[model samples]
Target: MSNEEKQAPQDQVEDVIESEVAQEDAALVDELTQANFRIEELEQALAEAEAKAAEEKDAALRAVAEMENIRRRAAIDVEKSRKFALEKFANELLPVIDNMERALLGTVEDEAAKAVIEGVELTLKTLMTAVAKFGITPVDPMGEAFNPEHHQAIGMQPSTEYPANTVMLVMQKGYLLNDRLLRPAMVMVSQG
Candidate 1:
């Protein structure tokens, strides 16, 4: 009816609309905050999962490296076994060779004995040749400098011919299998 009365009702309607808009804006802000929190939680979970995966991967790599090392060691062990398989057999055969050498040294110079000596000599030569083919080398340290690693000093002798600390006489011959000493040469060393 009057201008003041009409303006008052219009202002009331505008206030109601403004109040609804404010409530809606507050609801939207709350929802956006919740969504950002959920994203942060998911990011943290993803980071944790990635870190766990990385740790597992590192463990797997270490396991693989260890397996490879084991395989390499096994291969080396197999090769060594193959190289020294006949070590025990070679050791057992050494006494036979020593006896044969002793027999040859003790033979008398008879006409009939000479034929038997020749036969024994041929047999000994054949046996030595066969053993030499299998990486079995003789360690005959005759008149060489005494080495404790290869030669064992049984007794020291005063010698004018050899220098001091030299191998004067090899008592029993030593043998080597693949450059590894099977037995040390029993020798008499010159006194220093």
Candidate 2:
């Protein structure tokens, strides 16, 4: 109704509007700060996830490489087995060499017997040549110290010629296929 009363109402309205605007500005600032912080946190999390993925990929590649190496080694082992398959069969035929040697040295009566012995000699030489190609060497320790690992003690005899435990006489010869001993020599060991 009066000028003073009308002015008071208008002033109260302006104060209320200013207060509301201030509160709205403060809320907006707080929301923007929170959103920026959340974005930074998300970026850091993504970086950590990417690093973990890279590490896992490296481990998987190493595992695959190791498996490939193992497979290659196994292939080599299998090839070796196939190459050495005839080892056992060759070892069993060693007695034939001894028999052939005996036939050559034994006294023969007639010309026919001598011819047969000469034929056996040719066969023995051929067999030895073939065996040599396969890395099979004869373990003929004629004058060497007798090792029980390579020689079998068939008899103990007194000998002034040989050292103690040395091979005085090799009865049946031994053989080796590679580094492995196929058969030990049947020998006479000199006693101390």
For all candidates in order, the CA lDDT equals 0.93, 0.86
> What TM-score fits each model?
0.85, 0.70
Among these predictions, the greatest lDDT belongs to 1
Least accurate stretch of 10 residues (summed lDDT) in model 1? 100-109
What would the per-residue lDDT of candidate 1 be over residues 76-187, giving only the tens digit for each residue? 9998998899899999999999888888988587999999988899999999999999989899999999989899999998988899999999999999999999999999
Q: How many backbone clashes are present in model 1? A: 0
Off by over 4 Å in 2: 1-44, 47-55
Which clashing pairs does model 1 show? none
RMSD of 1: 2.4
Tell me the lDDT of candidate 1: 0.93
Task: Give the residue spans of candidate 1 off by over 4 A.
Answer: 1-17, 106-108
Candidate 2: 10-residue stretch with minimal lDDT: 79-88
Tens-digit lDDT string for candidate 2 (1-192): 899899898988988888889889989989999999999999999999999999999999999999999999999888778656768788667778878877778888889988888899999999899887887778888878979899998998888988888898888888888667888888898987
